[model samples]
Structures are given as C-alpha cells and as structure tokens.
Target chain A: MKTPGEQKDRTWILAAPGVGYLTVLYALPLGLLLLASFRLPEAFSISAYVDFFGDPFNWYIIWNTLRSALLTTAFCLLIGYPAAFALAWSKGWLQALFLVSLILPLSVGIVVKAFAWTIVLRSDGVLNQALMALGFTDEPVRLIFTETGLIFGAVNVFVPFMIMPVYSVIRLLDPRLAEAARTLGAGPLYVFWKIILPLTVPGIIAGIAFVFSLALAMYVIPTLLVGERFMTLSQQIARSYLYLRNETLGSTVAVVLLVFSLIVIVASQWLAGKVRANT
Target chain B: MTVLERLARLAVWTIGLAVCVYLMVPLFVTVAVSFSASPVFDLPPPSWSLRWYEALGSKRGFLPSLSLSVQIALISTGISLVLGTLTAIAVVKGRFPGRTAISTFVVSPLMMPGLVIGIALLQFLREIGYRDAYTGLILGHVIVTLPFIMRTVQASLSLFDFTLIDAARTLGLSYPKAVVKVLVPVLSPAYLSSGLFAFLASMDNYPISIFLTDARNKTLPIQVLEYLEVRPDPTIAAISSLLILLTIIVLVISDRLVGLRRMTDF
Candidate 1:
C-alpha cells in the first residue's frame, strides 16, 4: 500500500478537475450574485440593499416567507417523526410498501406535484367534493389561493425530506437500547423521550435545516398555488428578474434568501456538533 | 401488548398509512383526471378515454422541450457521473489537508437553494456575455446533480475492497486496468442508482432551469407550467402521468439493481 503522505500528495490530481470546475461555476456565480446586489444600474452602491430594507412590504414578505417555511418544517417533523420511527421499526413487505409509497412521490417532479395539488385543492375540486358529500361543508371551502393550502402542499412535498434523514439515523440505532430501557421499567413514551429522542436529534436538526431551506426557496409550489396574492421571497426574486426586469432587486432578494439558507446550514452544523459532544 | 401499547401501535400505523395515502393521492388524482372524458379535470373519470394522452402529441413546444430536457439530463448526468466518481475516490481514499473542506464544498450546492444558484448563474452568465441557453442549462444541472453522485459513490467506495485492485495488479494487470476490472464492477450498483436518481433530479429541475432557459429552450417542467397557465386541462395531467410512470420505472429498476434502502439511507 502507498504511504499516507504519497496518497495525500496524489489527491490533488484526482480532486483538481472537479474542484476547479466547481470553483469556476459555483463559487464564481455566487460571487457574481454578491456583486450584482451591490452594483446598481448607475454605479456600485448599496442603494438596492437600502431600497430593499426601506420597503416594509419587502420585510413583511421576508418574514412571511420564513414563517411559512417554519410552519412547513414543523408540520413535516410532526408527521414525519412517527412515520420515520415506524419505518425504522418495521420489517419486510410493510417497510417496502412504505418505502415505495414515499420514494415514488419524491422521484416525481415538484412541478407535477404542485399541479396535482392544484387539481385537488381547487374550489370545485376533489377535496371540496368529498367534504360536501361527507356533510362537512355546504359549499366548496376556500382552500386554493390560501396560506393553509400552501402549507398543506409544502408539507406533502417536503415531509419526505424529514423522514429520510430521521429514518436513516433511527434505522442505525441498536434495538437493545430501547429494549434495555423497557426492561428498566420505562414505558414506551418514556423510553422514546429519554433514549430515542436524544439519539435522533442530529437527524431532526438536519431535517429541519433541509426542509426549512427548501421551503424557503420553493418557487414552484407557491407560484402554482397562491400566485401574486401571497408573494414569497422566492416568488419576489423571480418576479423582479423575469417580470420587473430589475436585476438588482432580484439579486438583493436572492441574497436575503441565500443568507437565510446559509444560517440554517450553519445552525444545523452547530447543533450536530453539540449533539456529538454530548454523546 | 398492554392496551396502551396496542393503542400506540395502532396510532402509529394509522398515521404511517395516512401519510402514505396523503402522498399518493395527488398523483392518483392527476392520473385519474387525465382519463376523464370531460374537458375539465375530474376525479373518477366520467368515462375512460385516451383523448388527453392523444392531445399530448399535438401540443406545440411539448416534444421539443421534452427532448431538450432529456438531452440536458443525459449530458449533465454523464458529466457528473465521471467527475463525481473521481471526486468521491479522492474524498474517500485521499488523506489530505482540507479534504473535509473540499468534500463539504463539493456537496454545498445541494444545501444551497436552486433559485439562488439559478439567479446567480443568470447574473454570472450575463456578466461573462455567455448567453447560450443550452450551455448555461447543462452547467446549472451539473451543479444540481453532482452531490447525489458524489455521495452515493463515496458511500459505495467505503464498502469496497481495495485489496481486489492489489490482487489484480499482482496478476499482471496494470493499475488502471485493475481498477476498471475490479472496482468498476463492485461499484456498478452505486453508478446505476445515482445515475438514475441524478437523471430524474435533472429532468424534474425547474427553479434552476427557469433562469437559464431562453424563449425557445424551455425545459419540460417550465414548458408544462407555461402550458398550464394558458390551458388548464387534462393535457398537463397526461404529461404528469407519463412522468410519474417514468419515475416508477426508475424506482423499480433501482430497487431491483440495488435495494432502495441503499439509495435512500442518506
């Protein structure tokens, strides 16, 4: 076998091509984003940043974007945790059924899912028809073009993001840990709270980071579901770029979204570090 | 089981099965609606008809965008597979300073939102005066897909036996040839699943593709959304159903080639 030093020396050769491409494509583009935000039509200035912050409407939308994203993340966790636990604990065909059911939805396009939800959530749609038939409501409830509908769509679209990470972590847990807790007179809830919860914090953190970031940046769902009535930061960015033709404004919005996502990434990493230190 | 334990298990199964049903319903609705004889989307089709599927054929811009999407996905996935495999080898086997940093950087695109990357590329391309839509799209998709390939290959490589390469080398095969003979076969499952997943990811990509697409070069998702805006009917559903069928085929083949768990255990 080659010495560690020799192997290390050879790594640059293997890694250079990929790293160089990413630097040129990924890093440079982000740099351009930063620059575009600062450099306005006239000259290099923070006028766009000033303009963005000056508008309280913009602030509300940013806050709204984050709030909706948080709600989506919370819903994903609430639903996904139990489902993930079940998947982790199950065996054979039951597990296979759940896996296929979940993965198949995820593999399909977000556009397709968004389109599908529109069909189901429309005023005269399937859900409304079902509700009326079941005597829940006399008329079609206003689900489409509503925040509730968007959240429902976001959760349906993103719950898998939560489940996959949590399931991966939970599946690796030794069954003996739970069994030992049970033998010590701990109830199921107690065992989960004291043992499984602590162990799975990393996955939970990762899932939140992922779902939150994705929900924050999601353009397709909001565009298809709520449109201009409920403008997200992502929608605003796309609008400023494509519709408004204001590149500076779009870049400013993109920077804010990017910062929020970066914060999620860093927070997850920090939380994971803390979790590792505790164990 | 205790009564409470039984109730808890029942609740878990109920929630799990409910979640599964919730996930499947939308796609089911779309497919069902596509078969409806009515002009509008309706669940439990009034009568089964292939009209919408046939409508997909005459839909202007549908075939061209679909072809463009397929072309970009294939090209980008191929590039990512080669580059990602090389990078994974380095990350998994190389012992270098800042290796962790490099690995993180390689996977960083996955964490970043597609819109940010899309907008960033839009500005970057404008600055560089590189206005070719096709080139910009392939590059953007490469960014979108590299992480999946790298992660899967790295995972696969960790379980691979390097001694097989040594054995082949001792049997008079050259070093490169030994890797081709031994390592490639061992890692084929990773290649298969990642390639398939990456291809699907690229095909489904919208946010990134949106910014890069020119007037004539829209990706399939963009085209579908545009078409949906102008014409609200079962034709989009027909396209979606076909895409869903494609996704199912990909999943089944990947599951058969390598357990879905191996692909999904993230």
Candidate 2:
C-alpha cells in the first residue's frame, strides 16, 4: 500500500478505470441525450422544446404524470408506514418472516407484477368476481384501463421500496422514546406523531425520492395497465420514438423526465439535510 | 399491554398481513394460471395441467431470449463485480479528492429512470456508430448492476478491519495475496449478496433492455411484454412463474447465505 502511494498517487490509478468507463458509458450517453434534444430535425434548433411546451396536450400529459407520481408516493407512504412500523417493532423470527415476505415481492419482475394485475383488475376478473359474490356490486367495475388502476398498480409495485427504507430507519430508533412518551400520558397517535414520525424523516424522504421518481418515469406499469388511454411523459417518449419515428421529440421528453427526477432527488436531499441538521 | 395498545397492535398486524397478501396474490395467481389447461387466462382454471410450461419449450423465441438474458446478466455482473469492487475500494480506502462526488456519481444511475438511460444509451451508441446490440446491452446492464455492487461492497469495506491485511503482510504474505486471503474472505458474503442481487437486476431489467435490443436480440422481459401484447395466454403465465421460481430460489439461497436482514440493510 505504501509503495503504491509512494509511486505518485495510486488513488487515481485505482479509481481511473471505473470512473473512466462510467464517464464514457453513463455520462456521455446522458450528455448525448441532452445534445439530441437540441439537434432537432437536422438543424440546431429548439423546435423540439418549443413544440413540446407549445401544446396544451403535452402540458396535460406532464401534469398527469406528476399527479400520478405524487399520488403513488403519498399512497405508498400511507400504506407502508404502519406495516414498516410493525416490522421494525417485531422481534426475531417474526421480523425475519416479514422481511422475507417483503423482499419476495420486490424480487419479482415489474413485468410479472403488471401481468398479474391484468387478471386481478380486469373486468370479470377475480376482484370483481369476489365483489359480485359478496353483493358489493351488480356489475364488474371498470378498474382496468383507468388512471386509478395504474396508480394502484404503481403503489403495489413501489410500496416495498418505501417500507424497506422506513423499516431500516425505525429499527435503529430508540424504543425508549416512545415508552417515555407513553409514560408521560401521550396517546398512541400522539407518540407516533411526535416521537416516531419525526425521527423517520430521512427514511421517508429517501422513500419519497425513490418511489416518486420511479412513479414519474415509470413506463411499464402505465403501458401495461392503461396503455394509450393514459399519456405520461414516459409513454409519450416511447410512442414518439417507437411508433412515430421521431427521435428529437422522444429525446426532448426524456430530457424533461430526467430533469423532473433530478429535481425530486435534489429536493429530497435538501429536506433530508434540514431534518438531519435539526436533529 | 393496555386494551387500546392491544387493539393498535392487532390493527398493525392486520395491515402488515394484508399488505403481504396483496403482494403475493398476483404472483400466486400467475403461478396458478400457468398450471391451467385452459387456452385463455382464467383464474380458477377449468382443469390443471402443465401444458403451458410445456408450451414454453416450443415457443419460437422464448428459449433464445431467455438464453440472451442470462448471458447478458452473467457477463455484466462479472464486469460490474470487478470494476465496482475496484471503485468501491478506491472510494473507501483512498485518500482521494472528490471521493464523495465519485461515490455519488457511481450510484446515480440507480436513481435515474431506466427509460431515460435506455434512450440516452440508444442515441449515444447510434451516434458513435456502435451497432452491435449485444455489446450495447451488456454495457447498459453494467451501468444497472454497478451501483448494487458498489453500495454493498463499500458498506462492507467501511465496516471491515483492514488491520487483518497488515497482519497477514507481517506474516510474510505479499500485500496482494494478503488482500486476497483476508479481505476477500471477510467480504465474501457482501460479494455473494450483492452479486446475486445485481445478477437478478440485470436479468429482470426491461426499460434499459428495450431500447438496446433489436429484432435479432431481445431480453426476456421485452419478449414477455411483446408476447403479452400479441397473445394473452397461459404461456405468458408459465414464463412468469418460471421467472418467479428463479427469484424465489435466489432469495432462498441469499437468505441462507447472508440472511434477509443483512441483504435488505441497503
């Protein structure tokens, strides 16, 4: 180690190959993507950008994408929090069991998950069959090919991503904090709000950054569940390139999606920093 | 516990169990439907049979696509394990400037959308005149797999006792051999878990694989999606069940090797 360091800074030698590979592979590709958006229709023009923003339909698609993402993130948090809490508070074998169960779903491919949803959420599917059997409705509800179905599928797919981070954070939390709050006459809800929730902010922020970004740029779930009925940034990008044979338009939309993801990530990092500073 | 506390516990338990069930149902349905003799996708199935799984063998592109996915997954994972380990070592052990920045840069791919990465890579390769689809896909998967190895290996390295390497050195082993003997053994679990996850991530990747693949070479997920669009049958379910079975095997193996608790720490 000393000999290597003595030979004029071996750090660069060790780091250079991987860093260089990524620069060529990762950085260059993204740069070219950004560059492609500018090189519109064989001339240096911003028409792609102009065209994308010039249309109200495109703006609605962006808004719809954001709305779906925001809803998915919120729903994931709402559903995952208590489950993560339960997992974190459980002991030994029970905790392992829950962790195993959670990881199993996450390991399955997104394509399979979407494929399974076709059976569950389709008209005359199992969900509707059970509902009809229980007298919940006389007719099958149109859950498939809808925004609600898409969001539900997104939540199911991403909830594990939310729960795992929160669970990890909560596992390291002090049980005494909650116990002390309870001893001081705080209700369960109060204890959770004051003691547990604030401590898990970093994890929550991480989960939001992950689930929200994934939701915003999701191609599979939206395409599989709602298809052409829904138009999001990702779907639009794919359609423009694949079906329409328009590269500049697709790259422009992709750049916008990439920018949206980076914004969420940066914002979440800022929020996490503030929480850490406060604590 | 108080009555209210008990009630709260019961409620949490119910939700936890329900979420687990929700996660499993679709997969369970997929597996069940794969065993159906019915030609169409039916939940309960008119009769139970292995016709779909049998059909997988005779499907025109299924075997080739599965082979291509596996080959890409293995080769990409091998590349990532070597390069990502070196990078992780430099980031953790080297007294280098921009260590944090480089570390973040390496893992940033995981945070970005696969679709963006896919198209960006597609255009980049097209511009550079690199037309080989397999080469493009393997490289793209390296990007996908690198972060998993880097994060896990870096975490393990930070917690490792480097003194063991020095101790081995003092006992007359060369530094390289010392690292191979001591550090490698210590980080083997990290390697196994990370490598397994990375391999699975590569195999299951869709969005990245989509833009990189052409008519001659398509990954399993893209083929599966195409198959779903063209023919909605139990054959898709059969393919999915096989993939799910593969995942379960990996999960069980990883669980036995390093425990789920350790693997999910990330």
Candidate 3:
C-alpha cells in the first residue's frame, strides 16, 4: 500500500492540470495586468492611475459603467423576483415551459439576442411599428443607440440569472412557514416581509451581484445596442487597445473594472456563506 | 381570503406572464424577421418567405466563420470536459485543504466579464510572443468553457456516492478500474448537460473571441457583427434562427438526459 504522503500527492496531482492551467493562463495574465496598471517596465509609477483619474472623460466612463450596471441589476430584480414566485408555484408542464423559456433565451448568443433587439428597437423596427400601429406614436421613435435600448436588451439577457437563483431558493422554501405565519394573524405582506423576503435575500444578493458584475463588464450588448458613441469601461478598454494602441490605458481600465467585479463576487460569496451558517 | 390577497396573486401572475413574453420578444422577432419577405427588418414581414435562409448559403464570410466557430467550440469544450472533470474529482474526493478555493478559482471565469478576460489574455499572449490567432482563440475559449463544466461536474461529484467505489474495489477490482466502473455511469448525464452548456457558451462567445481572432479567423458572432455593420439585412436573422434552432436541439437533448430543472440547480 502507498504511504499517506504518496496518496495525498496522487490525489492532488489530478488537480494540477486545471489549476496549473488557470494559474499560467488566467491568474498569471490577470496578475500581469494588475501589475501593468501600476508599474512601468522599468520602475513603479502611479502616472497611469493619475492620468486615468485625471481625465474627466475617464470619470465619465467609470460612472457610465456603474450606472448602467446598477440600472440593469435593478430592472432585472424588478422583473425577475416576482417571476421566480410565478415559476415556482407553476405546475407540471407549465413549470417545464417556464424553465425552458428562461434557459432558451440564455442559450441564444448575446450577439444574436442583441441583434434581435436592434431589429425591434430601430426607428423603423418592429417595436416602433407595433407602437405606431397600436396608436402609441404616429411615427417611429428612436430607440437604437439610446440608453433605454441598451438597458432593455441587457435586462432581457440577464433577468434569467436573477430568476433562476431566486427560483431555486423559492423552490426549497417552506410554504408551511408562510402558511403558519398567516394562521397566526400575519397578513400576506407581513408574512412576506418577515419570512419569505428574508429567506430569499441570499438569492437576491447573488442575482444582483451576478447581474451587476456582468452588466458592469458587458462589452457586446452596449456595443451592439447603443453603438460606440457611448462608452463604458469595457468599450474603453477595447478602444484603447484596438483603436488607440494604448495598452497602459487599457490595462488600467481593465483593472478598475476587474476590481469592481471581484469585490461584488467575493462579497456575495461570503454573504451567502454567512447566511447559510446563520440559518 | 381578502380581495387584497387575490389581487396580489393576480398581479404576480400578470407580471410573470408579461416578463415571460418580454424575455421571448427578441427571439420571436428574430424568427419572424428571418421569414420576412422584405429586404429590411419589419414585423409581419409584409409576407412570409425563405429568401433569408437561402441567402445564408451565398452570404460571404458566413460559412467559413460558422465552421470555425463549431471547430473552436468542439475542440475547446472537449478539453474543458476532460480537464474540468479531473479537477472536479480531485476537489470532491481529495481531503486536501483549500479545495473550495481551488474550485472557486477555476469557476471564477464564468462570472467575470468576458471582455476583461479577453484583454488580459491578449496582452499575456503578446507578451509570450504568441502570434497564432487559432491557438490564442482555443486557449481563450478553454478559459470561457471550463467554468461551465467545472461548476456542473463539481456539483455532481459532491453529490456522488463515493462509497460505491469502495464497494467495487472490495470486489477484487483495482482502484482505478473501480472508480471508472462506478463513477462513469452517474457522471455521463452530467457530462451531457454541462458539456452542452460549455459548448454553447464557447459557440456564442464574442468579446473574448474578438480579441483572439484575426480577420481571416473570426468566429461566427464576430463575423455576423461585421456583416451587420456592412449590410444590415434579414440574412443576419436567418443565421440567428439557425443558431436558435441549434440551442433548442441541445436543450431537448439535455432535458432528455437529465431533467432541465436539475441542470439549473448546479
């Protein structure tokens, strides 16, 4: 029989390929990016950070990224939270259909989905056509290349992320808890506020963090739906490298964006763990 | 029940159905436009026709990129499945510390923004003097697809009955052979579900692939975007419908192998 040391080594060896690959590829590159943002090839410098923050346009970019992501997360929750209840209470084939509808759109490529939105949101597009036909407007209203259109397409893409998590939590939820609370003279609002809402908070946080992170970093949806006339951090990174050939600027913005995403993700994970422990 | 209760419940269902229709609007619109007889995008199409789907055949840059996308997806997802499964097994079965951290590290790519990863990889590749677009794309896609397989397979592994392996081992089978016999069957369905998810994520990926690809080696999404820039037409809708159909087929297969609801649990 192998020694305990040998057994441990053998077991850990199985993970080397994946862990080593990520370290070499993902972690190493991102580490390099973070390093690149702060230091020059020769010595350390804060010039990139200063230059980035010094620019009013860069502030606009950061604000733009945060605002869009916040709005996207808010809208997703507004639509998706109730839908989770609807989906969970649904029966048999209806449940399956709801799940399929959610997953199917998610499966559709972001490009195609964004492309589809352009068709709907363009001045002469389907949305305008329907709106005019329904007498909501006499002429085509501009939506493509607008902020409203960008958020609309993003929420459509990301609402599933919100719904699926909250739905899972709701699925495991004890309906009897709410029922019992109701019997004890608790109104529906009170039951929801005291029990159901508190229980689902973890799922809501996960969904919000996820959608926010994605919306904050999304490159495709904004680029397609709103066009490059508007700039988010992702677009700024792409433009810096692709158009301006400015790696330093690109890396700096990327690091900033990455920091925001990591903060949200790590915090949610910790919050979820804490919530699980408390319950 | 009070009318307030009934009213609230009705409101929930109404919003739920509205949200469902909202989620599906882009899809329905795209499919409708694909069958559009008109040259430009219009709802109800003026009349139904197959011109756009036919147009896909002769559309420049469509076929090459379509084939490229499929190839990259298959190759990268295959790698992620093999690598991710091994990683999942280690994380599940090993008594090592920081297993959770390692698992999270591997799966973190799925949650992070694609574009940042793209730029980071681009810079890293250039630093290493990597000049080939195809290899770069393969590496980038592996990063993108690995997380799907890892998350799904890890969930399955944690729930797996490892004691069965011990029972197989006690029956005069070798350790490796026992693991194979007992684990493979239960894991196969997970493989199908996660593998489909990984494949679709890779196939649909645009931001990361955009950085890795050259003009001649663009993925389908990038190619389609460029085409849309050059010529906005229903042919784009035609390609999208085909992709949507592909997703449906994948969904049906996954639903058959393992119930769709279970896939979501991971």
Q: List iRMS for all predictions.
A: 1.6, 1.9, 1.8
For every candidate structure, what is the RMSD over all alpha carbons to the true structure, in angstroms?
2.3, 2.7, 2.5
Q: Write one digit per residue (lDDT tens) for candidate 1, span B1-266.
A: 56788887888788888898998988788888888899777666778899989988898888899899999999999999889989888888777778777777887787788988988887788878999999999999999899888877888898887788889999999999998999898888888877877888899999999989999899999998888888788887787788789888877877787787766745
Q: List clash counts for every candidate, in order.
A: 0, 0, 0
Error of 1 at A34 (Å): 0.4
DockQ of each: 0.69, 0.64, 0.70
lDDT by residue (tens digit), candidate 1, A1-279 = 566655335866788888888999889888878876888444789888898999999989998898899899999999898898888777888888788888777655788788888888998888999999999999899998999999999999989889988988888799899898888899987987899899899889888888998899889999988889898999998899889998778889999988888888778878888899999
CAPRI grade, predicted model 3: medium
Q: Quote the true-contact fraction of every model.
A: 0.64, 0.62, 0.75
Per-candidate chain B TM: 0.94, 0.94, 0.93
Quote the positional error of residue A190 for candidate 1 in Å: 2.5
- Cα lDDT computed for each candidate against the true fold: 0.86, 0.86, 0.87
Model 2 quality (TM-score): 0.94
| Pairs with steric clashes in candidate 3 | none
B138: Cα error in model 3, Å: 1.3
Error of 3 at B166 (Å): 0.6
lDDT (tens digit, per residue) of candidate 3 on A28-67: 8988889888885668999999998999998998898999
Error of 1 at A230 (Å): 0.6
